[model samples]
Target chain A: MIRIFKIALRNLLRYKRRTMLTSLLITLGIVLVILFSGLAGSFKAMMIGQITDSSLSQMQIHKKGYVSSIDTMPLNLTLDTNKYQKIEELLSSNTEILAWTPRIKLNAMLSNFTDTTNIRLNAINPEKEILVCPDVGSRMTFDKGREPGTLLNPGEVIIPEKLAKGMNLNIGDPIVLVANNKDGSVNGLNFKVAGVIESILGPQGKEGYMHIKDAQELLRMDEPEVIEIAIRLHNFDRLDKVYAAVSSKLTGFINKKGVPEFEIHTWDELSPFANIAIMIDFMTITMKIIMIAIVLISILNVMMMSVYERIREIGTMSAIGTSPSKIMSLFLAEGLLLGLISAIVGNIIGLGGIFILNIYKISFAFGRQENLLLSPTVNITELLWVSGIVLLIAIFASLQPAYKASRMEPVDALGHV
Target chain B: MALVQIENVSKIYQTGDVEVAALSDINLSIEKSAFVSFVGPSGSGKTTMLNMIGCLDMPTKGKILVDGKQVDTFNRKERAAFRGNVIGFIFQSFNLFPVLTAYENIEYPLVLIKNEPAEKRKDMILDVLDSVGMIDQKNKFPDQLSGGQKQRIAIARALVTQPKLVMADEPTANLDKQSSINVIRLMREMKDKFGTTFIFSTHDPRIMEEAEITHTLVDGKLT
Candidate 1:
């Protein structure tokens, strides 16, 4: 066996130029796959991070059927203070839950004295909201007199940039918000603008922020109520496990009809960007298929040519009593060795390419989100999987040629020119 | 005792619609330790006779017994085993693996067929290399050696396994007169040293004169 391998190695080394060219082609394919995997992986991760940290907060819990009519901001479907107390207890005890914030969602009329428009608002505790959605602060642009990167303060509003621009609002300018409560009564409240926030979805958004106490007062609620609770987990990779655990615990809360009163959703379920993430995964798979095809065709071509050129040699070996199986193994060994060596070189160069990319710190924007820096990274498992695929494809590609060489009749082969 | 017995053996090859006879009713016996040669012109049955005797191919009729075993009855795998354990072969081209050194080429039979231990295989290879008088050229590749040196290595390769018989087809066809004489003498010396039977095919009168017994073939028939 060892002698056969030695011969196989020497044979590959015999045609130095052909071997080097074929190996270079295989190595380049592997390197391209690794680089693409790193870039696509990093891009998908970065975009998910932005969507979750800025607005979605990884996962969310809401009253049953609330998300169906979420666009309507139905105040009648709010989870009252008692229901929230139960949820707060469950969330506090779960080790996976890093932070959670409840918000009062409502739609109301906003007037900048001369101009009036309908606006969607989230009323939150500034301190708690920051823990659940930290990147939300990065979107805020303070108007002159206020502190930068600050969450909404009591009696102050952070209007969307589009709203601010249309209404010509500025910091310290007083505004009125009017809305109809569940009781069919209309009420209004006054506040001053603190800052304008960039919309995470797109520029045409009409969403604004206010302190929770102000929302309760403006809506004439006797006690605190919330339409939704956004949660952040200690590890984002534990999303499914935590989501399942939280869902199981909340399943015990039943309404009069015996159905669960709450629904849970991960960030991907709530964001439109999930489609693009899936598409990135699709593209990565496509790239791997291309890499496999490149390796297959090149190895098959090289092995077939090797057999054709060495027909007389094959005859000599066969006539000297080398078994057909051993002859087959010799050719397979060549391909296996080629793939192994090429994969190693490819991995080294690919990882180095990723390292260089990291050093450059690539930054780009998606939708209304800006300055998203991609740190391309590939894990060991991914590299191993890619290498394993290349090696398997190489063997498969060498099979027909190896078999052909092994089965050739010595008399006929020796007679070949 | 007879090391190889060929009785009324014939070989017919089909080329599309035509059947061509390469050997016909070849009857011969090679004694143990004999130096034998089959001489014929181009398109004669010299090579087909060696092929049938070596178990590289089976005769279309009759029986071929090599070392008292019916080689004509053997399957492909069985024939290979028979060839490996009982017979050795030398080719006109010197047929040394181009990538291997003379030492490695000589070691090929012992390593590939016998799977001999490295320590013992080294002794067997070196012994043949020395008997062929090419021990000094053992480390040189085939291309690095002269025609005589390459043929000497090919003889060494054939004799390394200590088979009962070694068959060479046109063994001196590609060598010069001097190289041809040297290769024939080396084979004779290897046979004398190892007590192995040697049967070679050639049209060269110089190579034919060296064989202790010679059979002439004309157009697939013994003449």
Candidate 2:
């Protein structure tokens, strides 16, 4: 048996061009699969990191029923001071809660002397806001009168970077904000531009933030009626557990309007970009399957030709008393060897390609920002999975050829040309 | 005792819609250590009989006993063991694995059937190569050697297992006169040295003249 295997190995080496062509086809398929899947996974991580770290945490708790009709502010389900304190106390006590930010969000139109833009106004506690948005401090500038780490005062707001550029507003610029108050009256107020924030949300830059109390006074709300609550957990893996617990607790708390309604959403649900990531993932998987199928066909063709070419030799071995199973094993060994060699080579090629892209800092402009697409990133878990998939494909592709070789009749094979 | 016993052995082959009888109701026996040849024209079932005797094929309607054991009753593994321990085969085309060196080709059967240590394997292979006068050509592959040298290596491969019987199908059909005589002479010398039975299926008159016992076949029947 061992002798037959050695002979098969030597025979395969004898036909160097054939073996190399077959191996090259398999290697390209494996490399393509790994490259596409790896990029898809990295893209997903980048999108999630951009969304979760920049704005939304793992989960969010909003005023009851606020999520269903976010277009219309539900003044009846307004979060009261007691409910805010109770929810904050409950979240801070649980070790799973990394941080939570209380927000009173509303839609308003902002106007400078020349330009006006509609934006979502978010009022938050600056100290807790920093925990959820560390980049906020870096985005602020002394050119806006409010320096880095400066505490914000009432009747002042931070505009998004894009909005500031569009309005041509700088430090101490007074902006007028108009919105419908809880009593259904059109109300307007003047506030100073304290800072600017750079965010990954979108090109529109339709967000602005102010002190929590100032937003209530400007909007004419009696108490702190929290509109949105963003919660960050210690680990993203415990998102489901925290969401379930927080939803159950918030269900018992009545809003200022004496209504019992609220909604809990995970980060994935809150971000539209997550769906784009999922679509990228599906495309990557489809590409991998197509690549594997092509490689399988090529490998099968190569192996079948190899077996046919050596029909006489196989018959000779059988005549010398080599069993059918042993002959099958010899062919299978050749297939496995080819697969392993190609896998190792393909990995090196894929990793090398990524490294080259990273070394050159290859990036492209998407919309407005330049983003890196191939960052030479791959987790150990993903590497193992791709390697396993390549090997299995190699083994599976060899089965039919090996079976054909094993079933050859010694007499007929000996007579074969 | 008779080294081989054939009792009404027959073989039928079906090719698509056509049925052909390659061997029909054949009965023959040869004693131990005899030099025998089955001689006939093309399509005379000579090669088919040799194939049956070599355990490469089974008789369709009769019994074959090699060394007093029923050949037809042996299962696949048993047939393999029987072929390894009791029979050797040589082909006219010199069916040596082309990629293997002459020495490796002779050493092939030893490694497969004999569990001898590495040193013993080397000694046995070299001894057979020496007997066939192929020692100087041991490092050369089949393509590098002459037709005669390749056949000598083939002969060595067959005899390396030290089987009781050696079967050759048109062994000299593809060789020149001198190389053919050399191969036939080497086989005769190998038979004398090892006391192994030699069987051949050929139309060559030289092989028939050299055989001590000759059987003639025509149209799938011995006549």
Candidate 3:
């Protein structure tokens, strides 16, 4: 085996140009696969991490009919205090429930003295909301001496940072919020800017949040309406079970439409980017397949030429009593060696390219000024997978030519001119 | 004792429905340690006979026995073992592996047999190289060596395995007259020194003259 491998190695080296070209193709394929897949995976991970940890837990529960349409503004689900207490008690007892927060949401128009913009207002309980949405408190600041725990004075509100800048409103500036009440009455409330919050949840500066009690009185819901419930599980992987448990426990509840129902939506269902991530993953796989095909063809062509060029030598070995299996092993070894060397080369080049790009802080603008999407980073798992794939492809590509070499008749081979 | 016996052997080749009788009803025997040659014109079955004798090809009609083992009945592995242990081959074209140096070419057979220790293989290769007068050119590739030197290395490769029989198919066909004479003389000397049988298929008169026994093939039959 060792002897045959040595001979094969020497034979491959004889055609230096062909060998180098084949290896280069393999290296390029491996590098591209690693680069794109790595970027896609990292980008998806970053997005999910940001979304899940910053605001949305793995799952969310809302009034069943409320989510179907956005036209029902200030829509609220009324939970019986005793029933709500039981649900909270059940959640607290279930080890799988990591955290939970209830919120009241309203779609309203915010108007400064000069400009007005539409926004989604989330009225949250600061203490309970922090467990699920840790980014909320730290993300807000007030120029007027209002801190996170400050009770919401009758006419105080927190505006998003982007909204305040665009509308030319400062902390003490007065604004009007116009919203539709559950009774189909249009209502307007005047409030002072207690704080400014920065959030990527909605458009850069288009959304804000307030204390639940303040929003309830402003939206004219005589009875408190819990608009939505967000829950975090100890293991996100058990999202289906958590959703099932919550749905089973809260099936009959009077919502804004005066119906008895609630709805459950997983985080993946809420985020449209989850589908986009899946599509990108599929695209990465397609690209890898195409690259592997091209590399295999290139390597196969080179190996075929190599086999033909060494016909006489192969014949001599056969005549000297080398078995067909030994001959096959020799060629296979050569292909493996080529693959291994090319993988190393490709990885070095790919990683080097990524490193240079990252070191220079190279970023491409893919969105508006405030929310630019950065190029995805590479990770170790992608590198290892690409290397393994390249090695397999190299071995696969050499099969036909190696078999051809092994099956040649010694007499015919030696007789070649 | 006869080292090789060909019993009424005949070989037929089929090329697109055209039957060609390369060898017909040939019976011959060669004793151990004999330097024998098969001389014939082109297309007269010299190489075909050599191929059969070297276990590279099987006879179509009759049995071939090397050291009392029937060649036709041997399977692929058996044939390979027979070729590796019982016979060595030197080709007319000095078919040294182009990528290998003369030393490596000589070491090739030893590596294939896989029974010898590395030190023993080294000693044997060096000894064979010395015997063939190719020691100085051991590091040179086939393309770098002269025709005479290549043939000498081929001879060294053939003998390094210490086989019972060494088959040379027109071994001196590519060399000049002086080199040819030197190659034949070296084979004769090696045969005497090791008591190893030597067989040749050639049209070279020098080899025919130097051979202890000469068989002539005419129109695929010994005459």
Best-fitting candidate, scored by DockQ: 1
Q: Give the poorly placed runs of model 1, Cα more than 4 Å off.
A: A143-150, A202-206
The digit string of per-residue lDDT tens for model 3 on A1-417 reads: 677677867877888887888778878887787667656665666566556655565677665665666344436444435545656786787789888887777888888867888877877776777778655555577665555455335567888787888888888888998887767688888888888876654221235777777777877876666767778788866878877877776765565777656677777777666787789889898978887786678767777877887898788878888878777787888887787888899999888767665555534332222443445577787777777777788778889999999888788888987
Candidate 1 vs candidate 3: which has greater lDDT?
1
Could you give the interface RMSD of each candidate, to one decimal? 0.8, 1.5, 1.5
Model 2 CA lDDT for position A32:
78
Q: In what order do the candidates fall by lDDT, top score first?
A: 1, 2, 3
**Tens digits of per-residue lDDT for model 1 on A1-417?**
677778888999998999999999999999999999999999999878777887778888999988778778889988899999999999999998999999888888999889899989988889998999888877778766556656787999889888888899887789999999988899999999888888876211346889999999999999989988999999999999999999999999999999999998888787777888899999999999999998999889999999999999999888989888888999998888888888999999999999999999889887766777889999999999999999999899989999999998888888899
* Model 3 lDDT at residue A245: 77
Write the number of the candidate with greater DockQ, choosing between 1 and 3: 1
* C-alpha lDDT of candidate 2 relative to the true structure: 0.80
Off by over 4 Å in 2: A1-8, A78-97, A109-118, A136-146, A149-154, A161-168, A176-190, A198-205, A217-225, A233-263, A371-374, B15-19, B74-78, B110-120
lDDT of 2 by residue, B105-205 (tens): 88877776666688999999899889999899999999999888889999999998888999999999999988888888889999999999999987879
Interface DockQ per candidate = 0.78, 0.62, 0.59
lDDT of each: 0.89, 0.80, 0.79
lDDT of 2 by residue, A64-99 (tens): 567767666555556678767877887887888888
* Predicted complex 1: CAPRI docking category: medium
iRMS value of model 1?
Answer: 0.8
Which pairs clash inside model 3? none
